[model samples]
Target chain A: MDLLYQIFVDPFVQMGTAPDLLVQTLWEGLVSGVLYALIALGFVLIFKASGVFNFAQGIMVVFAALTLVGLYEKGVPAFLALALTIVVMLGLAVLVERLMLRPLVNQPDIVLFMATFGLTYVLIGLGEIIFGGDPKVMIADQLYLPRGAIDVNMLGGFVSLQKIDIAAAIIASLMVAGLAVVFQKTRIGRALRAVADSHKAALSVGISLEQIWVVVWFAAGIVALATGIMWGARSNVSFALEIVSLKALPVLILGGLTSIPGAIVGGIIIGVGEKLGEFYWGPLLGSGIESWLAYVIALIFLLFRPQGLFGERIIERI
Target chain B: MRMKQLALGVALAGIMAAPALAQNSIFVPLLTYRTGPFSNSGIPIANGMHDYLAMLNERDGGIGGVKLAIEECETGYKNEKGVECYEALKSKKPVVVNPYSTGITLALIPKASVDHIPILSMAYGLSASAQGQDFPWIFNPPATYWDGLSMIIKYIADKEGGLANLKGKTIGYIYFDGGYGLEPIPLLDQLAKDYGFTVKKYPVPPADMQNQSGLWLNVRRDRPAWMIMWGWGAMNPTAVQEAAKINYPMDHMIGVWWSGSEDDARPAGAGGKGYLSLNFNSVGANYPAIQDIQKYVIDKGNSQTAKDKVGDNFYNRGVMNSVIIAEAIRNAQQLTGKKEVNAEDLRRGFETLKITPERWKELGLEGFAGPVNVTCTDHNGHHAAYVQQWDGTKWVKVSDWITPMKDKVQPLLDAAAQDYVTKNQPWPKRTEACDKSS
Candidate 1:
C-alpha cells in the first residue's frame, strides 16, 4: 500500500503543491517536441516521395550545420554562408540522385535503404575532414536569434523559459505551416503526390520521377538545416548531435511515416511523456528513464494501431 | 607462375625489412580516438601526445639515441575496435600501450597480462587497478578516481567550515551511467555514511548526454547544497548550460577532471564563469617542455595540433601523459643499460619510477605537475591535485594541491581489488621480487 501511494498519489500531490515546476517541465517538453518534430518532418518528406527510409537524414543535419559553421569560420558573411550552405545541400541532393539513386533505380526498397547507409558513412568522413571534428559555438547571436530566458510569475512561483526555445517553437510552427501550403497548393506538389502513389503510374502519366526525387530530397535538406540551427543553438554543434536523431525514430513511428501533421503531434506526445516520466516517476525506478520511455510509449501504441495515428491504412486482398 | 614468383619476392622483401624497422626505434602504440562523438576532447589530447614525442625526436634525437616510434591506431572510443587495435598492434612488440578510454582500459587489462605489455592508462581507468599486487600489468599513476572524489569532498568540507558542517546537507552526484562514470560511487556513498549526509544520484545515459533538462529540473527540485558531475564529451557542456539556466551557483558546482576541458565550458559562453573542476595536470604553455614542443613541433608545422589549441587543458594533459611515458622509458634504459628495453623491463621501470621536484626542474616542467613516485605496492602514487576554476575566459588555479584521504580510500581499493581477483579466478600471483635491481 505504501509503494502504491508513492507510485500513484505522491507525484500528483507534488505536482499540485508545485504548479510552477509542473509548468516549467511542460514547457521544456514542448520545446524538445518541436525539435523532434522538425527532424521527423525531414524523414517523412523523403520517405513519402521515394519509399526509401533515408538513414542518412541524421548525418545530413550534422553536415548541413557543419557546412554553415565551416563557411563562416573561413570569413564568409553569415547570410551568404547560409545561402551557400543551402546551395551545397542542393548540389548534394543532385549528386546523391545522380550517383546513388540513378544507378539503383527500379531496385528493391531495401537496396535503396542500404545505399543511404553508405551515404551516412561518406558524409561522416567528409564532415570530419572539413570541420576538423571539434564542437563549435552556434552562430546564434550572429543569426539574430534571441538569447537568455524569461521568468514568469504564476501559480505563486516562477517558471523560467529560455527565449531561444520560444523562438525555435515559433520558427518550427511557421515552417510546418509553410510546408503544408507548398504540399497542398503547388503544381510540383501534385506531381509529388502522384509519384508517391505509384512511381510507374506517375511515370506513365509523364510526371518525371527523377525530378520529384530531387525536389523531395532538397525539401528534406532544408528541414534538416532548420533543425541543425535550432539544436545547435540549444547546445553545441558537433557530431554528438547525430545521436539525438535516434530520438526522432519514435516520433516518426507515432506520427506515421507518411503524415506531416502526425509528425508534429507525435513529437509532442513523445517529448512530453518522456519528460514527465523522467521527472515525476523516474526516482521510483532509480531515474534515467527518459532514454527509453519514448520508445516504450511508441511500442505500446504500435500494439493497437500499427498503421500509426496518421498513417494511411493498408488493405490486402487474397 | 611468374605472378606467384613476384608475390613471393615482395613478401620476402617485407619480411626482410621488418627487423631493420625494429632496430631503428622502440614502438609505443597509442590507442586514440580522433573522430567520434568524443573527438571534440580526443583530438586535442591526441595531438599533444603526438607533438611531445615529435619534440623529443627533434630536440633530443629520441631517448638514449633511438627514436621513439609512436604508432597511432584509431579506436573512435569504442571498446570492440579498441581491442581490435590492441590485437593488431601487439604483434609489433610495443614497450607500452596507452589505452586512452576507461572502457578500453577495462577491456585490455586482462589481455595485457597475457601479452606481457604494460598498460599505461594515465589518470582514468579502474580505480582498483591501483592495487598493483593483484593487477601488475595496469598502471594509472599520479591519481585515481577514488583519490579525485575524496579530494572533492575534502574541498567541499573545507569551504563549509569543516567535515562536521556537512552532516545535514544534501549533496547531488550527476554522473554518466557507465563503468567509468560509476567509478567514484562506492567512495562517495561510504563518505556520505561516515559524515552523515544525504546523497542523491542522477545518472545521464550515454544517449541522453545532450538532452538533460529533466535531470537539471530534478536538481532544482532537490535543492542540493552542492552538485558534482562525472560527465564527458557532449554531456559536460550541456550540464553546465542547464546548471547556468537554473541559476545554480557555478562555484558550488564541480566536475571531475574529464569534465573540465575548454570544450566543456566554452559552449556556455559567459554563463560558465566560476565553474570549478579537479585537475592533475598544469594548464598553460609556460613550461619549458611546452615551449620546446611549440618551437620544435608546432612552429615547424610538424604537428597535427591546431596552433590555437596549444595551451588548452586536454592538450596539455596529453603532453603530461607523454612526459610520464618518456620518463618511464628513460628509467628503463638507465636500469637495463640497453637502449631497447623489452616489455618486462618497462614494467619494472613503471613499478620503480620516480618523478621528483628536482627531476621536474631538469625536464623543464617545473610547476607543471606534482611529483609522482610509483612504488611496487602503490601503482597510482596517490599524487595530489588542485582545484581550477573557469574565470569566463580560461581556467585558473584557485587552490593549492590537496592530498586525498588515503586512510579512507585504501581499504576500499583493497576490497575492490580482492573482489576482482576472486571473480577472475586463476589470476596470476605476483611472484617477482620487489627489491631486485633490473
Candidate 2:
C-alpha cells in the first residue's frame, strides 16, 4: 500500500506542491523536444523524397558541426565558415546522388539503407581525419547566439530559462514554419510531394527524381547544421553528439516517419513525457530511465495508432 | 606440390624470425580506443602513452638496453573487443597489458593468472584487485576508486566542519552507469551511513551522457547541498553545463579524477569556474620530463598530439601510466639480471616496484606526481590526491593532498576481495614468491 502511494500519489503531490519545479521540467522538456524535432525533421525530409531511411542522419549532424568548427579553427571567419559549411553540405548532397543513390537506383529499400550504413562509416572516417578526435567548443559567441538565463519568480519560487534555449525554440519554430510553406506553396514543394507519393509515377509525369533527391538531401543537411550548432552549444562538439541523434528515432516513430508536422508534435511529446517521467517518477526505479523512456512511449504510441497523429492514412482494397 | 612447399617455406621463415625479434626487445601491448564515442578522451591518453614510450626508445635507447616494442590494438572502449585484442596479442608474449578500461580489466582479471600476464589497470579497475594477496597478477598503482572516493568524502567533510556535521545534509552523486562508476558506490554508501547523510544517486547511461537536462532538473528539485560527479568523456561537460544552467553552486560540485580534463572543462566556458575535481598527477608541461617529451616527440613531429596539448591533465596522466610500466621494466631487469624480461618476471617486478621522490627527480619528472610504492600485500598504494579547481581558463590546485581513510576503506576492501574469491571459486591462490627487497 505504501509502495502504491509512493508510486502513484507521491509524484502528483510533489508536482502540485512545487509548481516551479514542474514548470522548469516542462521547459527543459520543451527545449529538448525542439532539438529532437529538428533531427526528426531531417529524417522526415529525406524519407519523404527518397523513401529510404537515412541511417547516416546522425553522423551527418556530427560531420556538419565538425566542418563548421574545423573551418573556423582554420582561420575562416565565422559567417564565412557557416556559408561554406552549407555549400559543403550541398556538395555532399550532390555526391550522394551521383555516387550512392544513382548507382543503387531502383534497388530494395534495405539496400539503400545498407548504403547509408556505409555512408555513416565513410563520414566518420573522413570527419576524424579532417577534424581530429578532440572535442571542440562551439563558436556560440561568434555566432551571436544568446547565453545565460532569465529567471522568472513565480509561485513563491523561481524558474530559470536559458537564453540559448529560447533562441533554439525560436529558430526551430521558424525553420518548421518556413519548411511548411515550402512544402505547401512552391513548385519545388509540389515536385517533392509528388516524388514522395510515387517515384515511377512522378517520373512518368516528367519530374526529375534525381533533382528532387538532391534538393531534399540539401534541405536535410541545413537542418542537421542547425541542430549541430544548438546541441554543440549545449555540450561540446564531438562525435559523441552522434549518439544523441538516436533520440530522434523515437520521435520519428511517434510522429509519422513521413509527416513533418508529425515530427514536431512527436518530438515534444517524447521529450516532455520523458523528462516528466524521469523527474517525478524516476526515484521509484532508481533513476536513469530518461534514456529508454522515450522509446517506451513511442512503442506505446505505435501499439495504439499505427499511423502517427498527423500522418495521412493509407487505405488499399485487397 | 609447389603451393604446399611455398607455404611450408614461408611458415618456417616466420618461425625463424619470431625468436630473433624477441631476443632483443620487450613487447608491451596497449588496449586503446581511438574511434568510439569515448575517443575524445581516449585520443589524448593514447598519444601520451605512445609518446612517452617512444621517447624512451629514442632518447635512452629503451629500458635496460632492450628496445621496447609497444603495439596498440584499438578496443573502442568495449569489453568484448578488449578481450579479442588480448587474445590476439597474447601470442606475442607481451610483458604487460594495460586495458585502459574498468570493464575490460574486470573481464581480464580471471584470465590473468592462467594466461601468465600481469594486467595493469592503472588506478581504474576493480577496486578489490588492490588486495594483492587475493589477486597477484593484477596491479593498479597510485590509487583505487574506493580510495579516491574516501578521500573525496574526507574533503567534503573537512569543508563542512566535520564528518559529524554532515548528519542532516543530503549529498547528490551523479556517475556514469558502468563498472568504473559503480566500483566506488559500496564505499560511498558505507561512508554515507557512517556520517548519517542521505545519498541520492543520478546514474548517466552512456547514450544519455549529453542529454542531462532532465537529470539536472531533478537536482534542482531535490536541492542536495553538494553534488559529487564520477563522470567521464562527454558526460563531464554536459553535467557541468547543466549544473551551471540550473544555477547549482559550482564550488559545491566535485568530479572524480577521470572527469577532470581541459577537454571536459573548456567546453562549459566561464560557467564552469570553481568546479573542483580530484587528480593524482600534476598538470602542465613545465616539468623537465614533459619538456623532454615535447623535445623528443611532439616538436619532432613524431606524435599525434597537438603542440598546445603537450602538458594537459589527461596527457600527463597517460605519461604517469607509462612511467610506472617503464620503472617496473627497469626494476625487473635489475632483479632478474636479464635484458629481455618475460611476463612472469615483469609481474615480480610490479610486486616489488618502488618510485621514491628522489627517483622521480632522477627520471626528470620532479614533482610531476605522488610517489608510488607497490608491495607484496598491497598492489595499489592508495596515495593521496589533491583537488584542482577549473578557473574558467585553466586548472589551479586548490588544496593539499588528501589521503584516504584507510581504517574505513580497508575492511570493505578485504570483504570485497574475499567475496570475489568465494564467488569465483577455484580462484588460484598467490603462488608467485615476493622479491626479497619488497
Candidate 3:
C-alpha cells in the first residue's frame, strides 16, 4: 500500500500541488505532438492515395534535406536548390512508379510493401554517394525560423517555451488543416480516395491510377522535406534523423492509417503520455521510459481497439 | 568498374614512383559511419579527418613531403562491417587506422595484430587496448574508459575532502545498454565497493530517450550526490535534460568523454547550464589548432561543419586525432627510410613518438592536448584529461588536467583484458611484421 501510494499517487499529488509542472508537461507534449503529426501527415498522404505504407518515408526526410543543403553548398542559390530538390523528388517518384509500382501493380499488398524496404536502401546509398556522408546545418537563418524562448512564470515556477517551437506547432497544424481540406474538398482528392478503396475498381471507372500516385507521392515528398528542415534546425541534419520517422509508427498504430484527425489526436496523446510517464513514473522503473512508453501505450490500445482510433474494422474473408 | 580502374591506377602510380613516394606517405584507414543513429557524430569526425589531411597537404606540402591517404569505408557503427573494412584495407601497407568506435576496436584487435595494422582509437575504443604488450597494434591516446570514470569520482572526492568521504553516499550510473556503455561498469562497481559508496544503475533503451522519470524519481528519493553517465547518441542531451527536470545538480553530474562532446551540448543547451563533463583532450574554442583549422581549413571553405563550428568539441577532437596520427607517421619515417615504410615501420614510428609542449605549440594544437609518449609496452600514448563545464553557450575549462588513479585502473584493465583472452581461448596468430634490421 505504501509503495503504491509512492509510485502511482505521489506524482499526481505533487502535480495537483504544483499545477505549473502539469501545465509545462502539457506544453512539452503539444510541441512533440506537432512534430509527430507532421511526420504522420507524410504517411497519410501516400496511404490515402495508393494504400501503400512508405517504409522509406523516414529516409526520404533525410535524403531530401541532405540534397537541398548539399546542392546549395556547391554554389547553387538556396531557393533554386530547393526547386532542384523538388525536381529530384519528382524524378524519384517516377522511378518508383516505373521500377516498383508499375511492375507490381497487380501484385498483393504485401508485395508492394516489401518493395519499399528495398527502396529504403537505394535512397540511403544514393543520398550518401551524392552528398558525401556528412551531416549539414539546416537553413535556419535563411528560412527565418524564430529564435530564443518565451519565459512564462506560472504557479510559483517558471518555464520557457521556445519561439521556434511555437512557430512549428502553428505551421504544422495549419498544414494538416490544409491537407484535410484537400482530401475532403478537391476533385483529385476524391479520385485518390476512390483509388484507395479499390485500385482495379477505380481503374475500371476511368480514373488515371498513374497520375494520382504521382501527385500523392509528390505531396509526401514535400511533407518529408518540411519535416526534415524543421527537425534539422532543431538538431543537426544527419542520417541519425532517419530514426525520428519511427516515432511516427506508434502514432500510426494509435491513430489508424486511414483517419487524419486520429493521427493528430493520437500523436498528442502519445506525446503527452510519454512525457508525463517519463516525468512521473519513469524513475520507479529505472528511468528512460520516454523511448518505449509510446510503443507500450499503443500495444495496450491495440489489445482493446485493434482497428485503432479511426480505422475501419478489419474483416477476414476465406 | 570506374572505382576498380581508379584503384589500379593509384596503386600502379604508387609502384612506379615507389622510392620517391615511399616511407613519407601516411596511409590511414578511416572506418566511418554515414548511416545509423550515431551518424550525427560520425559524419563530422570524418569531415575533420578529411579536412585535416587536406590542410596538412596544403599547408606543409604533406608530412615529410609525402601526402596522406585516408581511405574511408562506411561501417555505420556495425562490428561486422568494421571487420570487413579492416580485411579490405590490410594489404594497403598502411601504418595506422582510426576505427572511431569502441565495439569496432574490440573486433579489430585480433585483425590489427594479425594484419600488422596499428589502430588509433583515440578516446572512443576498448580501454584495455591501453595495455600495449597485449595490444601492440592498438593505441588509445588521452584518457580511457576507466580514466573517465575515475576522474568523475576524483572530482566528487575533492569536493568532499577525500575518497573515504564517499562512504554511504549514493552515485548514479545511467547508460545505454551495450558494451560501449557497459565497459565502465566493473570499474565503477569496484570503485563503489572500495569507497563504500552506494551505486544505482539506470539502463536506457537504444535509439530512444523519452522516459527517465523512473530513474530520476529514485534519484529524488535516494538523492545521489552525483550522476555519472556513460551514454552515446541522443541519450546524452536527453539524459541531461531529464536530470534537470528532476532537479539533479547539473554541476555534480559528469558524462564520459564520448557523452560530453558538443553534439551532446546543444539540445539541452540553456536548460543544462552548469553541466560538467570529463573530456580526454582539450578540444574547444581555446585551442590554437582550432584557430589554424578555422583560418586554413574552415575559412578556406574546406570544412565539413559550418564555419563557426571549427572550434567545437568534436571538430577539435578531430584536429587532435589528425595531429597524433600525423606525428606517429612522421616518427616512423626516421627508422624506415622514407621510401620503404610499411606496418612494421609505422609501429616503430609510433613507439618513438614524443609530442612535447614545444611540438604542440608548433602544430597549433597547444592547449588542446597533453604531452604523449608512445612505446612498445604503452599503446595508450597519454592518459590525462581535464574537467569542463557548460556555462550555457559554450564549454568552459574548469580544472587543471587530471590523471586516472593508476593503481585503481591498471589492475582492472589487465584482469578484464586477460579474461577476454581466456574466454576466446585460441590465441590469434602474431601480428608482428618482420623487421629487416632484426
Among these predicted structures, which one has the highest lDDT?
Answer: 2
Considering only N, C-alpha and C atoms within 3 Å, which residue pairs clash in candidate 1?
Answer: none
Assign candidate 2 its CAPRI class.
high
Model 3 lDDT per residue over B1-438, tens place: 999999999998888887555455667778877577677667667777777777887777777777776678888888888888888887776677878888888888877777677888887678887776677777887767888888889888987899999999999888877778888889999999999998887777665533343345445555788888887765676577667655678988888877776667665646678888887566556665566556677777766566666666776677778888888778777676674356777777776777888898888766557888776666675477888888887788898788789889989888877877777667563355433331
Query: In model 2, which regions exceed 4 Å deviation?
Result: A312-318, B1-19
lDDT of 2 at A282: 87
Colliding residue pairs in candidate 2? none
Candidate 2 local lDDT, residue A109: 95
For candidate 2, the clash count comes to 0
Worst 10 residues of 3 chain B by lDDT: B429-438
Per-candidate interface DockQ score: 0.82, 0.80, 0.31
State the lDDT of candidate 1 residue by residue for A1-318, as single tens digits. Answer: 988998999999989999999999999999999889999999998898999999999999999999998999999998899999999999999998999998999899999999999999999999988888888888898889998999999998899999999999999989988888888899998888888888988999899878998998999899889889989887899888888888999998898999998899999999888898888999888888898999998888889989887988889998
**In model 2, what is the error at residue B210, expressed in angstroms?**
0.4
| Model 3 CA lDDT for position B424 | 69
lDDT of 1 by residue, B59-166 (tens): 999999989889999998889999999999998999999989899999998899777799999989999999888888888999999999999999999999999999
Looking at model 2 chain B, report the run of 10 residues with the lowest lDDT sum.
B32-41
- Best model per DockQ: 1
